[model samples]
Target: MADKSLNKTELVAKIAASTGQSQATVDAVLGGLFDALAESVGSGTKVSIPGWLSVERTSRAARTGRNPQTGATIQIPAGHSVKVSAGSKLKAAAK
Candidate 1:
């Protein structure tokens, strides 16, 4: 089997063809959606598309860590991360 990963451009083209929209218009809409998602997540807001996916910001506390190369101990600082979870619909689609 060949690798069939879909990139942004291909995704845009596919959506455009399916929706009867111009590729440029589809790409712009996708871009806007991504921008909105980023803005919400950056502001610590959770975003959920029911039966599709969910994205949220997560917090990590500071802790101790190790330097693999030197085997030395180091301090790990607290930080935030984005978590994405696939919903039922997405999981079902993969099967």
Candidate 2:
């Protein structure tokens, strides 16, 4: 399984084969899906697929950190982050 992960081209090919669609179409749909997710999350909205996954924006407080090389203190700025949670169906599939 370690070496069996699919890249974009391979994933698109498989989906296209299974759905009887062209590889270009599958890739296009995937591109659209990622765009939509980014747009929604960027706007502070939670995007959920009931049985698959959920994505949302989260905040982090600014804090102090050390420089890895210099061992000097530094300030880390607060920022927004994207969080993705796998839903029930995804969990069940993993099990």
Candidate 3:
């Protein structure tokens, strides 16, 4: 069985071989897909790919925190984070 870890190059090669498409074409398509996903998620839009994954921008409120090394108190500014969740199909595939 193939290893579970697949980087971009390996994934593109596999997809190209399976679809009988050129590696360049597959790479381009993947690039465009990533670009679109980032653009949407960065703009506070929820992106959902059925049976695959979902991504969204999440906001966190400002809060106080402690410095472990110095044991000092600090303020953590509010910030945004990206949340990615795997869909049902992905979960099943893992098993």
For candidate 3, write residues 1-95 as lDDT tens digits. 76678999999999999999999999999999999998999899999989999999999999999999999999999999999999999999989
Residue 6 miss distance in model 1 (angstroms): 0.5
lDDT of prediction 3: 0.97
Q: lDDT tens digits, residues 24-87, model 1? A: 9998999999999999999999999999999999999999999999999999999999999999
Over the stretch 44-88, how does candidate 2's per-residue lDDT look in tens digits?
999999999999999999999999999999999999998999999
Candidate 2 segments exceeding 4 Å error: 1-3
Clashes by residue pair, model 1: none
Worst 10 residues of 1 by lDDT: 1-10
Error of model 3, residue 24, in angstroms: 0.6
Best by TM-score: 1
